[model samples]
Target: MATGNETQVREFIFLGFFSLPNNPVVLFLAFLAAYLAIVTGNLMILVLVLVDSCLHSPMYFFLSHLSCLDICISTVILPKILVNFLRRRNTISYKQCLAQTFFLIGFAGCEPALMAVMAYDRYAAICRPLHYSLLMSKRMCIYLASAAWVWGFLDSAIHAALASQLSFCGVNEIPHIFCDVPPLLKIACSDTSVNELANHITSLFVGLFPVLFILLSYVCILASVLRIRSGSSRRKAFSTCTSHVIVVILCLGNGFLNYNRPSAGYSLEIDTLVSAMFCIVAPVLNPLIYSLRNKEVKGAFRKVLNKWTG
Candidate 1:
């Protein structure tokens, strides 16, 4: 160990999936399969949203963005993970590590905010139907989506800057699969109090705030649904948003669990597993969750399928 914080940080060694058996080839193959699934699923969602005129609405628009974010988040994680596992190559340059941290957090931040936007769209669609068109016009949707992406980038950029500037004397092995903020902070020799504070502040706004907003939106939606006199209308309203609700729960729940923790409670094995869920499994399931559960999406997908196969 280089004492006294003398050495400048250069690179990091990721102790990837340390709990897994010592079988890099098998691990790599599994990760590759998962990565392909994530890509194919999200891409399918994107295509359906684009081609199906029936889906040319605010909900599908938001979903298209969500699918894009899923693809981005997974791409940032899985390829590198698959490659490293294959070659048993865990070393990442300082630049590469910081870039990974920046992109993944950026996309992760976007997800909750995007979900909140989708929630608002649902609220308008259910709670205020007369005003839905006026309230969620194309321009308004653009604004909300842009706001989500911008805030996410800004929040993550702040964290990335702080983490990259920290002094690292010697310890370079990252205890997790990726360069997430908590683990990166763990190995830093410099003081991280301010950095931790920044992380918590950003995490609060982008993560917790959006979750609360989504919950509040859904509560209002539930009340509106109850007020609807027709049973069929209520069922249709609920069906429209069920997939999004599930997606919100998975994305925000994992985010809250992963980031809103003290370093004192850090566990490498647990972190790796959680990262796997958030970075890989969630993205792969998003399209399936939305398509398989929603009647409209299934109908649209079938049309698209028949057009190709017929």
Candidate 2:
């Protein structure tokens, strides 16, 4: 019953980093260092948030969860990549590929929503200082975080189910380093028009909608900051928002570049780099940006460091 153009493919070969002629050892060491930095940095932040009493606020709570998510995100993708680099072959099974794709989509979709929640936290803090605690209550924070996780799981399940339905009866050489939706769909033997359309619409909801919410929340935050009468108060508010703003720009900018437009005729090389940034670099840098720049986080770090070392 097989057609001429269709052939069953069981595994995908990842064209991993350094497809060109280069020192594999050097690349492995470099990525290992980056991976270690990401792990230790995010782990430290997570512990600090958990142990430090002063960091038990809404902001730090969200940050701790974000750090946890970063760890999961990196763990899902980086170790395999590093292993592939170490080994001569870059092969992932069909099951592993599907699992990677599922988790990647889940976590990637959750990040912006989490960021938007953080933005709303900042808005409540700055714009309505008196009622900040009341607005971002413990219950509310838990609810928001639960909603994000649930939504991510739901979205990932939908996409993965759709992908599972498609028959991969063609070449299984994935152009990118990991299993991505567009690339996988390209090799499907059956009609993928429905899958592509669903991806587009879901990308709009998961990607752009959260970004718009974050932007709108920050616009209100900025407006409130400008209205403060005291110069010191204004400066303090601005400083508090700066770290989140930097993260927002990096995450949303790359997200827009990657997901906003249709995947038609996109360059594989550029997509690979962009995926690396959002998946690896952003998670690594997020904890660093907050811990290094925010005095409160630095204080918590010092306390946690002293307690552990002493």
Candidate 3:
């Protein structure tokens, strides 16, 4: 039985990217290309990390997990959007909406935690070179990866539980392309003070906290790099950290803009574009960033390719 405050929302109508005057064929082709790139790029990273013995380190291990997260995140949002584009219908069932939101939050939250772990890996490599292997052993890497997934799982569970508690009397249209927390909450008939507050607090802890930790790790890393007597060594260290920093900025910037807010007067257009940056662009860029910037990953890719071709 539905509670007094809990009313079943049968389906949500997605007011997608078509609100703009762009050509549907062009939009569909562009997103299709992007989706293909993200999947292929992340999949290649995962395969390279798994098959190449040279890439079997804490950093690549974390990268593999991050690639997995990205693939899942893109899959959760992009497929439904593609279907909507093809069929010209934006309807999604209530259960499907909640499920997509759950996985989206889970994988999205997992990303920063994985980045933080990678930062720690770099710190161990640069700051404690002698103890690097001891600190970031296979068991430790497994534990860190597991912990990131577990954290994401718990966070998503809380968000979904909170969302399930809300009542949606009417206005089933979701303003954004995807089923996100803030956009969905905007259409709720019941007072969403608790849900909004919880979303804000969780966003702070999940979004800001990992970013601060990554920044702190980089600070220590920078100090260590400065102390290195060789100029070449300093440049190398800086180059390695740059890729991670770029990804951190992209993830946190879009994330803060999307989740860290009250739903009042939110612009749907701006939100969709920002969400695309993280959901679509970030995943595609991550492997490319690391491949182009990190010599080890580049070398590993070459060696793998050469062996396959030979």
Candidate 4:
């Protein structure tokens, strides 16, 4: 419990769906399906990346990490949402809330950086093919992937540390679904100037900087792709990038909307939907995007299936 001059809040009530319909069973079933799909889809990608010889490349190596992050980001938020759908009240203990916030923000922060790394992987493959092996060596991949995860959780640790210092003072109603720094800050009765400042400053590094990196990487990639004179070569090069590009757009777009929501004008339902898009829909779609777009992934899936059946 946070100690302050007033009574401390030990738990928080989620107002995520308070403004929506009164059907718990329907909501429960719906979210359960989403969670299952998220796990199954991302897990398939991860397993394929591990087992398929054809997928043992820098691109797929980074993709496997992206799949893991997608699963983690969804798992951090969705299970709690599913459980709350069954309960009479949508609530989380203060400690649980903080833990959720930490992991959710950690995984969420990790994804864009990871995507940027994946873009760099693509950039190296297409733009610097002569040095692709050296640029994305096994050790290099491990280091870049580790850096993304560390960057995310380190940033998350800072936010979680700041959040822990906040004195709720009996005000614990979080306006959104899961525990996040923004909603938590909204309910904090103490002076939140420091938290807000940290949030904005970190948003630059954690959000904007990586996004800029991705755009720059893609710009270089597009230029390189265009320089290839053969139409077939251009198509093949573009095909390799389509899946990553779509996944990046979906994940980053939903995330941007989720985090940058305006302070006052939106309704609770809108808030809930936006968070769901980020936490639920994006994860579920990523594997499908790759599977459908990438011939390699589909062939790997077929190969795995044949081994299992035949």
Model 2 Cα displacement at 283 (Å)?
1.4
Candidate 2 stretches with Cα past 4 Å from truth are 1-5, 16-18, 260-268
lDDT of 2 by residue, 80-122 (tens): 8789877867788888988998998888778788888999999
Off by over 4 Å in 4: none
Error of 1 at 223 (Å): 1.3
In model 4, which residue pairs have backbone atoms overlapping below 3 Å? Answer: none
TM-score, structure 3 vs. true: 0.93
Best by lDDT: 4
Q: Can you rank all candidates by TM-score, best first?
A: 4, 1, 3, 2
Report the CA-based lDDT of candidate 2 relative to the real structure: 0.81
Best by TM-score: 4
Which of 1 and 4 is ahead in lDDT? Answer: 4
Tens digit of per-residue lDDT, candidate 4, span 72-104: 988888888888887768999989999999999
Off by over 4 Å in 1: 1-5, 261-267
Lowest-sum lDDT 10-residue window in model 3? 1-10
Please say which candidate is ahead in lDDT: 1 or 3. Answer: 1
- Report every candidate's CA lDDT: 0.87, 0.81, 0.83, 0.92
For model 2, which pairs clash?
none
Model 1's TM-score against the true structure: 0.95
Per-candidate count of clashing residue pairs (backbone under 3 Å): 0, 0, 0, 0
Q: Candidate 3: which stretches are off by over 4 Å? A: 1-8, 261-266
